[model samples]
Target: MESMKNRESKTAGSLIDDPVILRLFERMPHSVQESFTEEQLMHLKVAVGSRGWGEHAVDVRGSFRGWRHRYYYVMLFGRNRRHLTPGQKRIHNLISAAMLTGFVCVGLLIGLLGLYLLKSAAGIDLFPDHSLGIWDWFNSN
Candidate 1:
């Protein structure tokens, strides 16, 4: 029984020794801090520390010295970690499809316009005595 008590006290003491947990404990009122058990503190640490730092696909960090000063820089890029709802996913897909459709429509219009200009320049009129007047307007401009 004495050994068990000693072990429990050691575990609780170790939890208090953690700098992060110690800071959290110090911020709380003394009475409130003392109210929490070691298990509760362990749980709090787990919850707060779950999402750790530097978890990224591309993480570049460096420090440099210039002109008697020190500078630090970090660049991070990675896939998003957010969890989107089904509705949001659908909206994102719809927007992507709309953008792709708009690009294709614009490309086709530009290609057709170029072909029409080429035909007009070659003087190849598919219909006799009928003109779209585009060639005339283009020439005037």
Candidate 2:
């Protein structure tokens, strides 16, 4: 009866309650986690808990809810990316530069178009102005 009662009672601050420790456990490779000792787990819990979660932590946690396993797997093993060959690297750089240039050109064109539209017709407005505009068409009032 004494042993049964002792086993049933849990001390406060269990690893199961800590989100950071749980996350670290999940992020660790299966073999690594399996070999980890209770003391090591406790140390990890304290270390992770001491590092305060930042402003973006909530946003990250929200997104991770559904994809936690996938995210953990990728984080643990996806960093070993294949090196690009010299030609492939050159082509990648060229493509990146071209994309950046295209983006800048598109932005400039849009700005110029906006300026032209604003300056061309004084009566023309992007937003609904008076009774004859889009508001009246939708509201009929």
Task: State how far residue 14 of model 1 sits from its true place (Å).
Answer: 29
Pairs with steric clashes in candidate 1:
none
Clashing residue pairs for model 2: none
C-alpha local distance difference test of each model: 0.79, 0.58
lDDT of 1 at 14: 60
| TM-scores for every candidate against the unseen true structure | 0.43, 0.32
How far out, in Å, is residue 101 in model 1? 0.9
| lDDT (tens digit, per residue) of candidate 2 on 1-141 | 223233225466545446766688677775565565556667877776774333231232222445446332221222324588999999989999999999999999989766655544455555454333333343464
**What would the C-alpha RMSD of candidate 1 be, to one decimal place?**
12.7
